[model samples]
Target: MRRRLSEYGLFFRECLRNFHATGAIVPSGRFLASALARFVGNGPAGGQQILEVGPGTGAVTRRIVAQMGPDDQLDLVEPNDRFVEQLRQQFETDPALQRVAERVRVLHCPVEQLAHGKVYDLIISGLPLNNFSVADVQGILAALTGLLKPGGTLSFFEYIAVRRARALLSGRAERARLRGIGRAIGAVLDQHEIRREWIWPNLPPAWVHHVRL
Candidate 1:
């Protein structure tokens, strides 16, 4: 209980310090994390590789780690140094994470800047697309897509009706930016979306979009 509260405090501080990168007001709710980690598993012959981007303080990371098979490996890519430190500490102390600590690694970098040839069977993202420019979101999405193996799935979430709500209060420039982001996201969902999960119990409600190549 104390640990969870502390994690939330850290997340909240990160939000105030860097809302654009930290994204949400708090860590993802359990339901939303579960939906995002739904694809984490061992394949027919075992040994599935998973990648999680923007795993702030390991909210969704816990769910993903809980779902990982014996032979599964997870790489967490986080841009925030404090979040990365917290994640490392969790693996060192948290009982559940300790179980698969050997199979997990935390990378201190953005997904866009991660330079590696490794591809994953499943990729879950906690990035806030609505906070970025259209080009930035498109680039980030493209990079995530490129990191997946053939037929691999990518699960990411967007807050429900966030753009609309913000657009109502934002200036014309902000509204146009929001619309551009919507169009960029819509294009991907229209073509590659495999499933959608609506999680209403989250902070402000959210939709997890699962897509494939």
Candidate 2:
């Protein structure tokens, strides 16, 4: 309970400091985390390489750790210094995560800057796509798909009703930005969406998109 509350506090602070990057005011709910990590169990045999982008406070990170096999490897890309520190501590101190600590590497940089050519079997993104500009979203998406192996899976989420809600209150510029993001996301989904799940239990509700490349 205390740990959970502490995570929430950290999430709240980061959200305030980088709302566009942090995306959510709170850590992902268990239901949402489980849904996002669904592919972790269905991965191809032998072993799997996974990349998690924007892992704020290690909420989904913990869930992924729980689902990881002994041979699996996880690489976390988080630009926030505080969250990176917290994630390192989680692996160091959390009993459930300590066993797999050696399998995880926490990289403090944008996903786009990560070394290329190394492909992942699965990529789970916690980025708030809606908050970014169209060009940024496109570049990020390109980087994500680039990191994935052939037929690999990429999972990410966006809040439900966000576009409609923002459209109502946002000015012309903001509204146009949201629509541009939609088009960018749509282009990817139209081609590669294999599955999508709606999690109503999460704060403000959310939609998870599973794309294959």
Could you say which candidate leads in lDDT? 1
Report the number of backbone clashes for model 2. Answer: 0
Model 2 residue runs over 4 Å out of place are none
Residue-level error in angstroms, candidate 1, position 79: 1.0
RMSD of 1: 0.9
Cα lDDT tens digits, model 2, 129-211, are: 88889899999999999999999999999899798898899999999988999999999999999999999999979999999
lDDT of 1 at 11: 94
lDDT of 1 by residue, 1-213 (tens): 999999999999999999988788889999999999988884546788999999998999999988888999999999898999999999999898999999999999999998789999999999999999988999998899899999999999999999999999999999999999999999989999999999999998999999999
* Clash tally, candidates in order: 0, 0
Local distance difference test, candidate 1: 0.93
Error of 1 at 7 (Å): 0.2
Q: Which pairs of residues collide in candidate 1?
A: none
**CA shift at 145, candidate 2, in angstroms?**
0.6
With candidate 1 superimposed using the best TM-score fit, by how many Å does residue 15's alpha carbon deviate from the native?
0.7
